[model samples]
Target: MKKSITALGLMSGTSLDGIDLALCSFNNKKSGWSFRIEASETVPYSAEWKRKLREAENSSARDILLLHNEYARYTGEVINRFLNGKTKPGLIASHGHTIFHQPQKHFTFQLGNGTFIAAETGIKTIADFRNMDVALGGQGAPLVPIGDRLLFSKYDYCLNLGGFSNISYEEDGQRIAFDVDPANIVLNYLAQQVGKEYDRDSLIAQSGKVDDTLLKELNDLPFYNEKPPKSLGKEWLDSELVPMLKKSSLPLPDQMRTLYEHIAIQIGEVIHNSGTMLVTGGGAHNPLLMERITACSKAEVIIPENKIIDFKEALIFAFLGVLANQRQINCLAAVTGASRDNTGGTIHLS
Candidate 1:
């Protein structure tokens, strides 16, 4: 048996939701690894921070660098507040906010300075988990599958509904995972048009009707037919998805309903097999969207407790940090199409 260690994981998803912090303890037994969530919280982004991140994709190089350090300090401050009076974790693992993710160009950038985080918090930090995979010609994404395989293998599928939807499962003795479709990214975009932050359980979507034409167009998207190991980025949404949505003349509610149906159809097509699928991420909270998914598939959707639904990614990142510290394989080649299975993450010591 391996000695148990506690670690704090920080996640800033593309949904621009907030910084999710999860403190978890992990132990490795002969059977496998097991973990318990000690605590978790979300620090919502201020309007200024949100706007800066939203525009980061277009920001100048100097500005990007400045924002990177600023965000790192902000993350450290959040961690400091959350950890006040708590037992200190052994490590801090951060999945920094993604500013650019064009793996095809052999580049992906997640902005949070690990050195700064470690300096500010006086804790060893691990971050920038994707660049090595991209350098090895991989998608460097959907990295959560390794956690699913080790921690939640009972389910036939594991799906995360964050800014985008991604699924992971075993096939022919290897773990396979990839981005499925846009989820909260599109939903939140439409919700904002109506002066709301998000659709809130997809209530706005449930109140309207699905547009067949829009559904068909969404279904016909070329990326959907691409082979596995592919990932989607904000650039794709800005260049292709949002533009297509703008072409439609539907009302806000109707657009939400139509996109909701589209997301369901895309996800259903991938996991049509009959078995239990563990669902997490912000999208799991959308009951109406969940209904749409159930209506279109044979699989049973199992949503765990609220804490699991909201902070699974952060917990997994913490687990990934544990693996990295041990020099164990954390990122899988089968999932990312990298040259080989390898450990990926940069560590910073204060």
Candidate 2:
């Protein structure tokens, strides 16, 4: 029998939609791992859970710590049931829920207890993959680029339309990635104003014309002017975007329209013309937004297999965990502007 490597990669994206659990089998050489996604599901968060996570940043330190262990145990329980006690994975690689991320302050927090997970599940785990980079003066972000570089290198670029629009591409042998702009985050916020979670196929956006004033202001935000190795967070949106949009008093459709275009321009500027970009994530389902991106950049947008669209982040985080398990360099200096290219992640045993 061949040696088998089974991994369960967990991701809780910015959308706050739910937890994406991906089980995959890796059986091959270091550069030639063949993976078949065993089973996957998006366990939607309850209304109460969503509310707590959405307001978690402003909550007390004690509550955040409590939630940290709570989430960790919840994750372990989920994994246990997913396995059904039938099989045990070689590794549990978690991209734990991000609660606080402020690289400038040299502090970042992702709340899921790997140690607690190991203790509870009696399974080896690796997690908290972002803090060390920040401690070393790095953005501790876009860690998926390492996975992009290794697993999906054939494409010129990989753009994920998750809660936020982010792109990762190779340039002269170095990989680059950053939050392009708000994707579902802004659009969904506008959608909620009209009692919708998201605009299916970007119908609301297609129904309205772009507000030039709003579009121009969004394009000129100081964050856009920053070169690279930068990222966005809920805090920035709360402080900058929400207030600006609320004060604009523009119709919701116009806000969605302008925000969609803003995301297009933000992403379009980074990818080269005519380059093939493998686009994925829930936002890839947005036809109007994809149409705008194609219009803005004139690039070839390719959506791969449905599984890839829905679970690529979870898959790539699995790859990141594998690299970290091997004690290899998984975060790049060029990408996150870290002081050094570092092997990041902590491991916990049963």
Candidate 3:
């Protein structure tokens, strides 16, 4: 490895909050390695792009392709603006926005085009991190556990409270991970009803009553009954969750409250909820929801520094790109249900 390398980590999660760009420097010293985040920013999405992304689940195939190309260009512009032509990084690692994630069908799509990123940025790019795993009969979702195991193993377990909730932990010394429940995705939908971006700190949940019936229905969803190596996307939310949420006559607050409990319960059971649980992601900002999970589980929810809590996945995706460059395994067998641990991702040379 070079004495040091700079990485521009980019992420746009399901929360639809914005794109997070982290300029990180990694140094390998005699004592292993350490990373220092130098500059970072959350680039809010334009309203047009936001609507298109949220409504992309049912978009026409032609439109999906069009958006895929457009989004990749948009991503490149964002990265350039963030860097201001400063030090050029060795490469770019983008967890392109997930457009369709259905591993059961043996397919997944993260739309931002790697070729476009490479052409626009004139640097090597790595993307499409999940499809190869799905092709290998693995759950293409929850790909971050590879990074969780390699980069943040100090914690007994790591849970990302992102657009959806997922956990990464060691089982029998092998990394195991999967989606726990829908987090900000459902919560933010309800929050939008109240004319806000999200339930700021999940205060709305604290103000509402938990509808037990709705909670029961949510917890009983077939996805929860299924085993790991499973994942959920907006399509699942629209097909399964939206109908369930719509069938209930409950008001927005009650809906949010019940959904909150569902997330808490599913997440609690997935992880023992014990030991140092390194929780990060946009949903980590949801205090009331976190409090409820804490009340239900005997786990120490450790919210790391804001940069990590917000952009850890972006950072890890960048790290995954590095591992790919080194021909190291970036996909864990136990985590993805693959036949073996594999290095999965497409690399684009400048």
Candidate 4:
């Protein structure tokens, strides 16, 4: 295995906030793995791109294919601009925008074709990191746990507050992780109702009152009751959660407040009585949500610096690429319920 590797990781999360690009270097030693984010930036999606991605799932096959390649080219262009005058990374690992993720149906698709990425950027690229696990009868979701276990072992629990919130930690002798609940995705949608991109610092939610009735309904969601090795997707949100929120007839602020409470409660139930939980991702910026989480859970919540909170997922995806390049396991059966531990990326040479 190489002693050190520098890679650029690109991540477009479910929240549609932007494409996060992080230039990172990883060093492996007998003791453990360590990493540094050399440079990072998030290029926000334009209105047109956002609309296309939001509706890609419902588009025709040909249209979806076209958008897939177009998105890859766009990603490549973004990388070119991001890399100008900077140290060029040896590889590009992209967690492509997910168009559909239904592992139970035996398929998952992430846009941004690796071939196009490599051709455009003229660098080795890795993409499509989830389908193999799904093909192996696994959820093919929550692929971040291996990174959490190896790179963030100091924390008793590593919780990411992304488009959706997922928690990873060691339990017994194995790593345990699963999607906790919807976080920024729902919050952003509610904020849009009020002509805001997102509830800044969760101010909207902080001012509103939580509706107990709505809170109870959200708490009783079947996904919350499902066992670990399970995951959630936008499809589940649309079919299960969206309708429930739509029927509430509550003010948007109240809905956001209740949703925040619901998220806190679900997370508290999972990490209850734990020691320390490292929280990152965009949701960590929402002070009100953090307060609610601290109020409901026993664990001490630690939010790292802004760069980490914003770019941790991109950093982990880059680590996943490094592991794949070394033929090391990046997806764990204990976390994703695959038949066995596996390396899960398709390498596209430049």
- Tell me the tens digit of each residue's lDDT in model 4 across 1-350: 76578999889999999999999999988889999999999999999999999999999999999999999999999999999999989899999999999998999999999999999999999998898789888999899999898899999999999999999988888999999999999999889888999999778998889899999999998888899899989999999999998888898888998999999999999985659999999989888999999998889999999989999999999999988888898999989988988889999999
Q: What ranges in model 4 sit over 4 Å off?
A: 1-3
Quote the lDDT for 154 in model 4: 94
How many clashes in candidate 4? Answer: 0
Residue-level error in angstroms, candidate 4, position 195: 1.3
lDDT, candidates in the order shown:
0.93, 0.85, 0.83, 0.92
lDDT of 2 by residue, 230-310 (tens): 988877888888888999978888888889889988888887657689999998888988888888875688989888898
- Residue pairs with backbone overlap in model 4: none
lDDT of 4 at 349: 100
What does candidate 2 score on TM?
A: 0.96
Q: Per-residue lDDT of 1-350 in model 3, one digit per residue for the tens?
A: 56677877788898888888887777756765577777788999988989989888789999999999999999999988888957888988888888778777878888799999989989899888887788888887677987786678799889899888888888877777888888988888888888988888667877779888888888889989888777788889989999988778888888998888888888888766468888898877777788877776667878899989988888887787777877888888787887777888899887
lDDT string, candidate 1, 1-350, tens digits: 56789999999999898999999999888898889999999999998989999999899999999999999999999999999989799999999999999998999999999999999999999999998888888999879999999999999999999999999999999999999999999999999998999998677987899889888998999999999999999999998899988988888788899998999999999985899999999999998998888888779989999999999999999999989988999999999999988888999998
TM per candidate comes to 0.99, 0.96, 0.95, 0.98
- Which lDDT value does model 3 have at 88? 84
Q: Which stretches of candidate 3 lie over 4 Å from their true place?
A: 28-33
Backbone collisions counted per model: 0, 0, 0, 0
